[model samples]
Target chain A: MTITITAFERSPDGGQGLARDTRVRWALEEVGQPYEVRLVSFTAMKEPAHLALHPFGQIPTFEEGDLALFETGAIVFHIAQRHAGLLPDDANARARAITWMFAALSTVEPPILELGSARFLESDKSWSAQRMPLVKDRVRDRLTQLSARLGDADWLDGPFSAGDLMMVSVLLRLKASGLLDEYPNLSAYVARGEARPAYKRAFEAQLAVNKPPAG
Target chain B: MTITITAFERSPDGGQGLARDTRVRWALEEVGQPYEVRLVSFTAMKEPAHLALHPFGQIPTFEEGDLALFETGAIVFHIAQRHAGLLPDDANARARAITWMFAALSTVEPPILELGSARFLESDKSWSAQRMPLVKDRVRDRLTQLSARLGDADWLDGPFSAGDLMMVSVLLRLKASGLLDEYPNLSAYVARGEARPAYKRAFEAQLAVNKPPAG
Candidate 1:
């Protein structure tokens, strides 16, 4: 069955590859799966058709034959489960890898997202400047623990798996914030993820769609 | 091998069952698995010993023989996969069920957690009063979409799978905020989850541990 997924018609990040479709794309690339992308405009995303695919009206819904999935973590995990490269063969190792995937989305990403809201959504508010530090500190606290755990490790656990894929994608959001730089090991860790051939392919794929017309 | 999980020595919710451990316990109960709980104080959670089991330094962690796992989503999922009951037998349905689990933790829970931060962590801030509406509205936006998707359905998807288990757990957090009541179907959905025999057992178990000493 041909796998089909959705991507933002024009990503808000303007091709930085922070959009979630990049994560799915990276997973597919890692697994050597070729898939098709359907672009959805911001307006159309809220329309009945797209909403049917993703109730939350988000981009990056996955469809393979009769199976449809929306959450990025799920999409990546599904791809990982179907393919060999993304998960370990050992039962315990695979469970630990999946744990890292949850940790990335559930524990680590929330604070970074709060920082995004403070900078973009609430920037014009009277208290934005005053509250920025608190939001950033919360992100730092999670990163501190993550950095300590990482401790110069190349990937989160044993050889790059979906866990590292998800965690690196989540941490990439903080690249512009410079908070990731505070933990040099994490910064290097993110760099190693970026250095992957699969990641580079995925990044360029999304960038090609979102990049501006040259003069 | 014996299954053991960790919980708070004293839950901040005072046994209302909002803690993530309750989610794990509920999954175990649904699958009819008996497990032991190890309560950890806040200080010990951050110490080296506990951090070895849970890198993020939060409860609960799951341990069985040599295998250990953390992150409630992963732990509950681990139980669901090992035992029958929490997931569907069909492959597509199981994938969709896992998607809901991710949606619960990644999409729905984050805004609710932000509401937690706004109410508890930032309540003393100068901007608390003025900024709360934004936080509340963000949560409402997600709930509105969720309510629309749920419609008259008893669960988010077919049957009462892990997806419902997780979505219900995520929505339970909003009960105190009064946001859940805005959508009757969602409110009913959560009530249905709470009404489950497994849920009741899990809730009572946590309550027993966290309940204050009687006079």
Candidate 2:
């Protein structure tokens, strides 16, 4: 079924692919499944219409025919499950890959998200500086173990799967913070995910929406 | 295969069933699956051995023979996938249930966890009071929509699946804040989750570990 997903009318990151729709778009592209995008404004997000699709009022809700899905991890997980390229065939390895997806979002991403919340929503707070390092450290500590486990390997576990898709997505948020550069292997890992033709297609798709209007 | 899961030797919450392991334990109980728990002290948790199981230095790692998984969501998902009753049979409903799991962790849980971090880790800061309300409002916003969607329903979708298990676990974190009471439906919903025999069993099990040593 051809899918239609929502995106931030304009991502705060200026088309850097922080909008999770990039991951969904990338997954669709990887499986060579064409889809449509529905850009949502901030005002529209708080309304019941958008909340119906995403209870949290977030972007990148996926809909196709009778099925509607929210939560980027779940959407991407569904995409990976339905599509061929995003998951592996081996049962155990596939489970491990799925574990990585959870690890990326549940473990690694939480602190990074905390950092973002501190910077944007709590920047005026006097403790931003003090609190930020602790948050960053938590992210780095997780990254350190992850990087060590990864070593010089290209992907997280075996081959490219939804795990890598998610891990790379989590790491990208740290790029602006300069913390990701601390781990060369992770930087290269992010690079490999970006280099994927599918990732490129997805990035371009999100960029198209968030890119500045014509001169 | 029999599974062995790691839990806090002494849960910080004194096990009022707030530990992540409680969710896993409840899932096991719900599935009528007997499992083992391996308690790890804080020191052991940070050591290399435990770190291998959980990079974030946390408890509730699941091991079923050769298979090892971290992240409560992944472990719970694995259990639900392998066993019956934790997931819906209908494909669309199953997808939506899984989506709620992601929504619980990525969207709803993050802010709640942040509120925890802010209280425990950053409470000394002067701006904590100022930042807390903003963070709380974000959480309330999510709960309002979730409660609206749930509305007098017994469970999230059709049945008592892993989605409600996850959503309830996330909401439990906010129970003490009285923010949950603001949405009476959500407060009642959490009570429903707690009232489950599986949940009671899980909570009591964790509480045993949380209680202080014999005097």
Candidate 3:
């Protein structure tokens, strides 16, 4: 079955690959799966059609035959579970890798997202400046623990799995914030993820769509 | 192998079942798995020993023999995959179920958590009052879409899978805010979840630990 996934016709990040479609693309690339992208404009995303697929009205919904799935974590996990490259063969190791995926999304990403909201959504608010540090510090606390646990390791657990993929993607959001730089190991970790051939391919794919046409 | 999980020594919610451990316990109960709980103090949660099991230093953590896992989504998923009751048998349906789990933790819960942080962590800030409406509106936006999707359905997808288990758990946090009541179907959905025998058992178990003793 041909897999069809959605992406932003013009990403808010302007081809930075921070938009969630990049995560789904990266997972497909890692697994060497050939898929098609159906780009949706921001307005179209909120329409009844898109909302039917993703109740959240977000990009990056996955469809293969009768199966329709949304949420990047689920999409990535679906790709990973069916493919060989993204998960370990050992049951325990696979479970741990999945744990990292949850940790990346649930525990780590929430504060980073809060920081983002402060910078973007609440930028004009009176409390934006005052609340920024508290938000960043919460992110820093999580990164500090993550950095300590990483402790000079390359990937989060064993060889690169969906966990590392998800974690690296989550940390990439902090790249502009410079908070990721505070932890050198994590910075290097992100760099290593970026260095992956699959990641490069995925980044280029999303970049091609969101990049502006040359003058 | 005995399945053991960790919980807060004294839950901040005072056993309201808002803690992530309650989600895990509910999953276990659905699967008819008897597990042991080890309560950890806040200090210990941040310490090295506990951090070894869970890099994020929050519970609940699942341990069985040599395998250990954290992040409630992953733990519940691990139980669902190994056990019979919490997931559907069909592959596509199962994927959709997992998608709901991801939706609960990633998309739905982030704003709820932000509302929590604003209320608890930033309560003293000058902008707390001003900023709260914005946070609550964000949550309402999600709930509005979610309520629309749910319509008259009893669950997000089908018959009481892990997705409903998780979505209900995430929505349970909104009960105190009364945001859930704004969406009658969502309120009823949570009521259905709480009414489950498994959920009831899980709630009481956590309540037993965190409930204050009678004089």
Candidate 4:
């Protein structure tokens, strides 16, 4: 069955590969699975058709034959579970890796997202400047713990897995904020993830869509 | 192998079942699995010993024999995968159910958590009053979509899978805020989850720990 997934017609990030479709693409690349992308405009995303697939009205919904799934974590995990390279063979190791995946999304990403909402959604608000530090500090607290745990390690656990993939993707949001730079190991960790051949391919794929056409 | 999971020695919620451990316990109960709970103090959660088991330094870490896991979503998922009842037998249905679990934690819960942090962490800030509407609106937006999707359905997808388990848990946080009441269907949805025998057992177990002794 041919795997089909969705992406933003024009990403809000303008091809930074920060959009979640990049994560799904990266997962597919890591597993050496060929897939197709269906672009959905922001308006189309909220339409009944897209909402049927993703109640949240987000991109990167996966479809293979009768299976339809959403949420980048779930999409990535589904891909990882069916494929060999994204998860470990050992059951215990695989469970730990999945734990990291949840930690990345549930524990770590929430604060980072709060920071984004402060910067973008509420940029014009009266309290934006004053409240920025509190939001950033919240993110810093999480990063501090993550950095400590990641001390002198290559990937989160052992070899690269979906956990690292999700964590790196979550941390990448903080690159512009410079909070990730404060933790050198985490910065290096993100760099290593970016250095992966699969990541590069995925990045380029999303970049191609967002790149401006020549006049 | 006997399964052991950790919980907060004294839950900050006073045993309302808002703690992530409740979610894990509920999953175990749904699958008819008996598990042991080990309590961890807040200070110990941050210490290296507990951090080794849970890098993020939160409660609800699962240990069985030599294998240990953290993150409630992952722990619940592990139980659901190994045991019956929490997940569907159909591969596609199972994937969709897991998708709801991710949706619960990643999409719905993030905004709710922000509202929590705003109310609890930033309550003293000058901007709390002004900024709260924005945070609340963010949650309302997600719930509106969720309520729409859930219209007249007992569960998000099908017969009381982990998807409903997670979505219900996430929605329960909003009960105190009164936001959940705005959507009658969602409020009913959560009530339905609470009405389940497994959920009741899980709730009572946590309540027992947090309940004060009678005079």
Candidate 5:
């Protein structure tokens, strides 16, 4: 069955590879899967058809034959489960890897997301400036723990599994903010993920779509 | 191997069952697995010993034999994968079920968590009153989309699986806020989940631990 996934017609990030479709694309690339992309405009995403694929009406819904799935974490996990390169052979290690994936989305990403809202959504509010430090500090709290656990390790666990993939993608959002620089190991960790061949391919693929027309 | 999980020594919710451990316990109950609970104080949770099991220093963490894991989504998922009851037999259904689990933790819960922070952490801020509506609206937006997709269905997908288990748990946080009541079907959906024998057992067990001591 041909695997099909959705991407934003024009990403809000303007091809910075922070949009979640890039995460799914990176997973497919890591697994050596040749999948098709169906780009959805902002308006089309909220339409009935897209909503059926994703109740949240967001981009990056995965479809393979009769199976339709949404949520980047699930899409990446599905790709990892179906292919070998993304998970470990050992049962215990695989479970641990899956744990980190949840940690990334549930524990780590939420504060970072708050930071995003502070910067973009609430920037014009009267309290935005006052609230910015609190938001960033919450993010730093998680990163502090994460950086301590990570210490000098390359990937989160052993090899670069789906956990690392998800974590790196989540951390990439903090790159432009310079918050990641505070934890040198985490900054290098994200760099290691970017250095992967599969990630490079995935980044280029999405960039091609979202890049502006040259003069 | 005996399955052991961790919980808060004294839950902040005072045994209302909003803690993530209840989600893990509920999953274990659904699958007919008896597990032991290890209560950890807030200080211990951030210490080295407990942090070894959970990098994020939050509960509940799962341990069985040599395998140990954290992140409630992953813990519930691990239980679901090992046991039969919480997941569907069909491959596609299982994938969709997993998708709901991710949706619960990633998409749905973040805004709810934001509401939590706004209520508890920033309640003293100058903008707390002004910001309350914005925070609630963000949560309402996600619930509106979820309610529309759910319509009259008892669950998000076909049968009650881990997806419903998780979505219900996430929505349970909104009960006090009255946001859930705005969507009757969603309110009813969470009610159905709470009404489950497994959920009831899980709730009662936690209540026993965190319930106030009798005079």
Candidate 6:
């Protein structure tokens, strides 16, 4: 059966890889997996049909035969497991890569998301100005630790695997916030991820969909 | 070789699983892994020895033979991959579980952490009261979707797996906030996780370590 994924008919970021689906699409593209995308509007996302596949009713649900999956981490992991390119060959290295994957989502991503939510969703609130700094500081705290550990490395762990992919994706959320610029190495790290032909393809694809209706 | 983990000698939570060590302990217990805990005073955590193992200068770093790992998600995942119980045998089911782990950390946990940050770190600020409701609403929105999906279900996915462990851990963060009570199913769902024997062992073990600082 053909692998199929649902993506926003138009992403809020206007095709920026910040959209969750872009991560899955990029992962598939990296693995050279030919697939189809089912575009979904924001309204359709909340409808029962989309909700059936994704309980939270979000974009980027993966379906292959009887298998249906949500959560970009899981989808990327599935692709990595099924196709060899995204994972390392050695068992220890593979385990380490997987560890980085979890680290990306669990440890690093939390503060970044907070920074974004505070800036975007709460910007209109009375506390936005005060809250933004606290949130950004938390993000910086995580990044300081992560950057120290990553210290002069091309990727988070040894070599780029799904770990780096997910980390870069999470970090991209802060692109507009200018906080990422505080860490020169982290900025270059994201550039490296975006430079990948696979990521470029994914970026362009998502961009094509959201290129309309300028907001 | 026996695995060793670092934890707070006197936890701020007074042994409540709010401490990161609790998650690591729960994962170790779930995997039937024999491990020893090394208690670190707050000062020691900032020192080089602890910082070398965990860049964040936090507790619950794992060291076994040559391998040193931090981040609860990474540690729990390492435990699950090495052991049999926490992951599924089926390829797709395993992917779904892993997805929940990511969702727990990335999607659900961020807002709760924001709540924590708002309540503790920023509580003294001039805008604390004004900022809280905005943060609470975000947490509630995430809970609403998650609770709706998890309605009438025992776990986040099929049976119980590491996914549930992570999801429960994420939900536990909001227990004291009373915001969790806004979603009855999620509150009950957290209660169900707390009732597990393994969870009991994990919670009590951490609680014992930080028991009132000898008061």
What are the candidates' individual DockQ scores?
A: 0.94, 0.73, 0.94, 0.93, 0.92, 0.68
Clashes of each: 0, 0, 0, 0, 0, 0
- In candidate 6, stretches whose alpha carbon ends up further than 4 angstroms from where it belongs are A213-215, B213-215
**CAPRI grade, predicted model 2:** medium
Docking class of 6: medium
Model 2 spans with C-alpha error above 4 angstroms: B213-215
lDDT values for all models: 0.95, 0.87, 0.94, 0.95, 0.95, 0.85
TM-score of chain A of 5: 0.99
Error of 3 at A156 (Å): 0.7
Question: What would the per-residue lDDT of candidate 5 be over residues A1-215, giving only the tens digit for each residue?
Answer: 99999999999999999999999999999999999999999999999999989999997999999889999999999999999999999999999999999999999999999899889999999999999999999999999999999999999999999999999999999998999999999999999999999999999999999999999
Listed in order, each prediction's TM-score against the native is 0.99, 0.96, 0.99, 0.99, 0.99, 0.94
How much TM-score does chain B earn in each model?
Answer: 0.99, 0.96, 0.99, 0.99, 0.99, 0.96
Which sections of candidate 1 miss by over 4 Å?
none
Error of 3 at A60 (Å): 0.4
Lowest-sum lDDT 10-residue window in model 4 chain A? A126-135
- Residue A199 CA displacement from its true place in model 3, Å: 0.5
Interface RMSD of each: 0.5, 1.5, 0.6, 0.6, 0.5, 1.7
Model 1 misses residue B205 by how many Å? 0.4
Candidate 6, residues A162-185: lDDT per residue as tens digits? 989998998999888898899999
lDDT of 1 by residue, A1-215 (tens): 99999999999999999999999999999999999999999999999999999999998999998888999999999999999999999999999999999999999999999999999999999999999999999999999999999997789897999999999999999999999879999999999999999999999999999988899
TM-score of 2: 0.96
